[model samples]
Target: MPSFYSKKDLFFQLFENQNCLELTQLPYFSDHSKETFTLVLEAAEQIAEKSLYPIFREMDRQEPQLVDGKIRIHPAMGTIIRKFGEDGWINAIFPYEEGGQQLPWVIHLAAGFIFQASNYSASVFPFLTTGAANLIRTFGSKELKEKFTPKMFAGKWQGTMALTEPDAGSSLSDLTTTATPASISGVYRIKGQKIYISAGDHDACENIIHLMLARIEGAPSGTKGISLFVVPKIRLDGAPNDVLTQGIYHKMGYKGAPIAHLMMGSQEECEGYLVGEAHQGLKYMFQMMNEARLGVGMNAVAIATAAFQASLAYAKERPQGRKISEKDLSKPQVPIIEHSDVKRMLLFQKSVTEGALALLIYCGILSDKIAQETSAAKKLKMEALLDLLTPIAKSYPSEMGVKSTSMAVQVLGGAGYTTDFPVEQYFRESRIHPIHEGTTGIHGLDLLGRKVWLQEGLGWKTLQQEIQHSLDQVKSIQELNDLGHSFEEIFLKFNHSAGELLFKRNLGPEKFLADATLFLEASGILCVGWMWIKQAISAQKAISSGALEQSFYLGKIETARYFMEYELVKILGLIPRFHAASYPTVTMEKDWF
Candidate 1:
């Protein structure tokens, strides 16, 4: 019961330093203020600690079960859902007219981190529901929104995105699900099996709304012909829809939320309403997918944050051998935290988790700016920035969260490996994130294959320009000059490396993308390096102003420095890997493996 997550001071200071409240000037958030943001965060924290945190272990211990084809989750989850729904955290970013708080995306994300850090499994249903509902609100017809959005937003119903199938996995082009036109104007009969669906079914709500993907019969093959649909578990006429729970998947982590295999139209009665025009399901779903990717990044950070705190606390109290310089035979043992190696491990976790959090929070702020900006050009530029950052934002944190939590385990030695501490659970849960939104492989392809080159490389260029602006701000700070210059070289190297890939495009797409994952890994490291530098600048400003929380500000600066000196240098190893003309992966024969 030692505090797993109690970092309100650091969290709030990040919000203030990031200028999250500046979004209030926009009409969408005009009614809100700093006070409103704090109120919502407190409400979320109250629910997280009072309701969710207390039962996190129990929920994990007793994973959801499939009883007579009905999935039964932890009983405690129902209360958490109700409390969040009532408090509007379930729909915090929805428009006010739609019964939401109309809070800025950054603040909403901050609140989400609180709950996720406290108990991600309990918090996941609402997160899935919010993303599903947002897709409907953005693209669904009036009838669809009116019937579904309110119920979902009110927490009377749950929502899920149904995209993955038995064979498709991440390849939407291969999905075999089919839809046929129904007599109703917008309705279609859905017939497909979606696997690994989170919150796919549960008894905590009156209904489960599935934002599903399928192909119309005889539609063109691959992703182009696919379409999106609103498939409900229960039909409007009060009978069960043809959606059947084939089985509930037991996972190593995130055990509280059921991962289900679902069969739609098994009884040939599954009715689905299309969200938009045909052959646009992938396009529409990509929006939700991107949102989910962002969520994945945040979830990874939250879990790692908890692991770091637990390990840090234990390190401070656990007595071990004397320091390297000490004659240990004659003296009492010092805390493990005083040991250089233990501190190094903890610092690695701290740097990665904190830097990842700052990067994702910055993405959230850009998300709000994109929503509120009036100028079409500015909006387009903001969109490009988001496009470029999304892959790194999703992959870096996820991939590193696994590494960070593993270090947390190393910090505690034996206890970290056992259920006596939650670090092991954190480690298990963090592994799924890289595979969840899109595998690191897929994201790397997206980054190097498409996002970086899309719109004539506008996204890549815009991101570099912004990073340069941050470095510019630190020029007059003599102490940061050398680090700022080092980051500049890092940026130039990334830009040049990307240019090399673009130049090699004529060699064949296969060769061009041969080391795409390595490219992504390199980019992720550099992007996070940029974030740490920005945080350092923010901390420096606070320190100069003689902030009351001097220790907090000092900690931020030191963490930033640690990341730059230790983690950021990783990009050097990948640079040569990026330059290889013939990747061994593509050269190996199929029989070799």
Candidate 2:
């Protein structure tokens, strides 16, 4: 069973006391899990520390260029990524039956942080391939899976999820990609233009599997009419080697990760095979998309985490600000760390990144439960929890991840805005997340809109009960008692605030909907406060046990305390705003803008 206290010792000290992380265990962690996962995280850190981070600045400086309607990525990056595929990095979460590491999603996500933090743009295509590949495996026939799984898992063929169009984006029901049955055996004739597909035209792999969505003939209109297919850039039968560059998109960030505007079946037919039942594409695609939402959230957190580390290092080394107690203005202004405001920014960044990571990894643990639990009832509960957490997991961390990155830039001042440092790049990369899987508002609406209604509200109730349990546990631990009490107050404030909003005149329109973003933020903060108290309790135990890294443990306790003091303390404000949730922003005239 996962303790309220154990994970704290293993989190931040991942680099130094990874052995301690090794010693730590999750209730759902299989016997082989620690050995299997820690290396993934370590390897992720390696990629971030080595390959991706070094190139991030250059990546921002030189966005992917569209030359003759094709994208040629950084010279050695294609090879490096191919090496990543060869190394099983892309296939960690694939089923072992599929020639993958068969690791849990959380571990894959933990490792993902390394890649995304280092260079998100470069990893987008390969990672998206994993999602696309899994979609095929889940919904496609055995023939499709057998034919495509190996190469995709092995990174021989990359993958892309194409849902957006010139007019349809967010509204899948309104998409126009058309599909017609082919005269050929087991094939669907696909003809559509898919835009903004990452790795859509990359030369990293032999074939790019386009999971294109389209409307079947005489089908129900809107989302129900759409069917998904495994449409490859090049038709592959017995032998699979086609590196055709159809078209490329010039993008804002992630320049190294090529984006494409594909015109499928315009030439020789873009042969595709149906994955799931006709008109059930949206359901199947959501599996990958939901997974990607979690991935995107973690990516945002990782980027922010990297910025925090860099900013922390810079604040300590940059000799600009003087000590608050220093009488001498001439005292060479010690490092920026001396300034209370700078420290506050650093703390906020650290609080979000570390706290976000804690929640993200634990969500992974919950995933393991949802996947592995044998009992139907228990598995059902796990599924509900998973559903409840996904929106917050995707929405909360992503917003704060961007917030943290921006603050990192603030820490660097002018240098942060320029290409000289990578924080600005972190911000730029993070800026894409709100739109990556779903916008913050969508996630917000999901949380308030759908999550509250799912499983008869069992998931939300379970989460509230769990937080209550943690709140009680906080009172039991002497070291964490004060923080616990403070958190309890914050928790109650948040709960009361949410209740007022719900009871208020019906959560008015976009203005109230806009509050949905802040609602996600509050929920996420409350959730992490629970995680932090648990972590601090563990840190207290680690210190009691005469651990060598008491300083590290102490830092964990301190950071959690700081979070309670500042971040969690802010939850008190939501009460007043939430009371006005029923108001409508639609009252405004269109011409007012």
The numbered model that scores best in lDDT is: 1
TM-score of each model, paired residue for residue = 0.97, 0.91
Q: Write the per-residue lDDT of candidate 1 for residues 190-220, one digit (tens) a residue.
A: 9989999999998898889999999998899
The per-residue C-alpha lDDT of model 1 at residue 78 equals: 74
For candidate 1, the TM-score is 0.97
Model 2 agreement with the true structure over 1-593: per-residue lDDT tens digits: 10111223334434232232332243334344456556666676666666766776676677666677566677657676677788887777665666666566666776677677667777676788888988888888889988887888777788889888878888787888787888966577777677777777765577778887888878999887889888886676643223244667666666678777777666545677888799999989898888888888888887787788788888888988567677888768788888989989998987788777777777776776577677999888878888998888887788887788899999989888888777777787788887888898788888877786688888888888888887787689887788888888878778877876655425344554656777877888887777787777767877888978678778878888899999887777665667662444456677886
Worst lDDT run of 10 residues, candidate 2, spans: 1-10
Go through the candidates in order and give the clash count of each. Answer: 0, 7
Report the Cα lDDT for candidate 1.
0.85
Number of residue pairs clashing in candidate 2, backbone atoms closer than 3 angstroms, sequence gap of 3 or more or interchain: 7
- On TM-score, the candidate that comes out on top is 1
